[model samples]
Target: MAWVKWDQILLPYDYGGLNVSSLKLKNYSLLTKWWWRFLTNDNALWVRVIKSIYGQSGGLGCNSPLPATKMKIFSGRNWSQIINIDQTPSKLGCNLSNVFVKDVGSGLDTSFWNDIWIGDLPLKDAYSRLFRLEVFKDATISDRITITFDSPVFSWAWESQPTWRTEDELASLTNIIKLHKFSNNSKASWTWKHNSNGAFTTDSLMQVLTSLTAAKLPPSSATDLSPFVPKKVGIFIWRAKKNRLPVRVKLDRKGLDLHSTRCPVCDDDIETLHHSLISCKFASNIWDKVRRWWKFNQLHLTNLSDIASCSNPKLVTTLGVSIWQAVVWVTSYYLWIHRNNCTFGKNIDSAAKIFSDIQGKCFEWINCRWRKGALDWLSWITNPCRFDSIFTKNGIG
Candidate 1:
């Protein structure tokens, strides 16, 4: 059974999720890139074929919508759906067109009023009053600009005389257009605003989509996790933080017919994620060993919230705190594994053996992933913090 909302699970790590990629969002990004290709690469054979079939006024998603006849005849195709891709039908409710930008050059290709080539929005949106008075809505940049006397001139074919409000909008729009410098030598180009170099990339687009759709969770539930341990361990901790770890009580709550809700390890209390990993008798013994190994004061960790504070920054340097975090999480991983073994009636390692095993595991991981190269088995087991002897010299030892 699903414990968290699918939308919440789709968020990136910083937003209380595993950063699982959304296939719908990914497919949308890919289709949007294809739309970019169709508009920018006018010489491609497929683009030429599409332009011929869809009518050249606007290719698919460029300016004007497809003609009413074609809209109904081929409306079932993916291309038709892509052209009208707006925020309303989107998975994350993000407007894909917001990332689409138009760069004007010779202006033969770009639509003057329909495309977002200038200002914060499309000219049709920014100057809607003036747009209502235009006779040709799909006119290109070249259609509106006339070069005479070595200077560019503006021309507009209005439906009729404009109201006072429409005249003011026309003047404002004209002044904004004058400030934009256009080149007569180059062709108009389309750009993905989410990326550099005006190119489209799935990775860049996914990040943009994540930012738009990701919901902010409470700070207590979300945290910036460390990369010291493997992802599986991190995922376990994340699930534990959310209290979704399939413990006996949680399973019973989910309508599973378990024999009992008591923790199988000690059979002392109801098994919740916190009780299974933090305050249980067997788990508490492992935590105490880890606490002393890290040289923290004798502070009891009755709550899972106390685990993070166990690695006191004042007791160890920043580097030492990172190493300590790895030890804490690795211990948590093995403790859960031992609990499973006990539940299944398998032989279990003693507490000392578990501690020794984690020491070796942490030593191998830290020595390889960390670049200091100052750690040895002897130093790690005794005091892993005394890195390069400089850490001890600083009196953090």
Candidate 2:
């Protein structure tokens, strides 16, 4: 049957000028003659030969694996020299025969084999399974041609697969230690706790002492001693550790003065860092106007430590913290300026005026420096009548 089909596909393309009878009468019989004809024919000959063997129904004959085996032997020799060889139709024809042999040898039922041979499998399932098998995962199709070539499958799987590493590639991973002798004549000063004969034992104290010696600041005629002498070291330490409290209480005290060790806005007793910042009556009023202008409630900032240690520290990049810090700094600067005005110039500005100045200055700074995004501060402060004009002028909305 196969010989009859091969004759029909190859008889018209023979170039030997010999009649079919003479060709058949040669040492090669019909099949061998047809095989010789198929190989020696033009490029179109392979397509016709494959069609004749497999037929329009796309079913490989029981003996189709033989040609596939021959093709595989031919492919293996110059394997590396072939580029896009798998994308040729002849390669696919060869693969079809190999697939059939694999399926039959694996003991798939005859019915299942018939379905696959005739291309009757569900399209999605066929494609997925073909992809899952490394054999067809990297197959490529060009025009009407389909090709499957073997890749470096399992050995280089690490390069093919995705993964993450815990440590950086740049780690040096080494260790070293050493010791050195000490000298009493060394000029290094000492921390009182580590000194035996006025030389430092700890690394930090030794560093400080060495720096002081290098600067020539120890008992030297060139160094000024007036600034170095101190009367209230213990008192300053006690004030730093124990005297601080919230700003609001200090703001509400009687007769509070900036120079009298009390909050000027509030005459609270024992005025401290926290009391001077958030709790002062002047600060509270300023924060209130700021919150209203920004359409946010005043942040309950209790102490300077809260401002300093906030996890999301204030930066020009931060929207809310940046705005808040701007307000705080401007308000502090204005209050100090007002204090100077009161003491030296004998001029006083109302808290409302101070708050207004802070808002105006903050908006000016933000508008000048922050050039991206439509932040809430912009809309909240810009006059409604001039909002569109400002946006158009600045090329922003």
Worst 10 residues of 2 by lDDT: 169-178
Per-residue error for 90 in candidate 1, Å, reads 5.1
Tens digits of per-residue lDDT, candidate 2, 1-397, equal: 0112222212211221111222321221222223323222324655465545443222232223235655555444332112112222132232212222111121112222122322334212443332232233222111112112311111111223322221121011000001111222212211222235432223323233233323432121121111111212212222222333323234445434445655555565444555555666766776677656645534545655444322233232334454454555555456555544543556678888887777666666556655563334555364312333334334322
C-alpha root-mean-square deviation, candidate 2: 36.9
lDDT of each: 0.72, 0.36
Model 2 pairs whose backbones collide: 86-147, 246-275, 247-274, 247-275, 247-279, 248-279, 251-266, 253-267, 253-268
Please provide the root mean square deviation of candidate 1 (C-alpha atoms, Å).
4.5
Clashes (backbone N, CA, C under 3 Å), per candidate, total 0, 9
Candidate 2 residue runs with Cα over 4 Å from true position: 1-259, 309-317, 342-345, 371-397
Write down the TM-score for model 1.
Answer: 0.77
**Index of the highest-TM-score prediction:** 1
Q: Estimated TM-score per prediction?
A: 0.77, 0.30
Using lDDT as the measure, the top candidate is 1
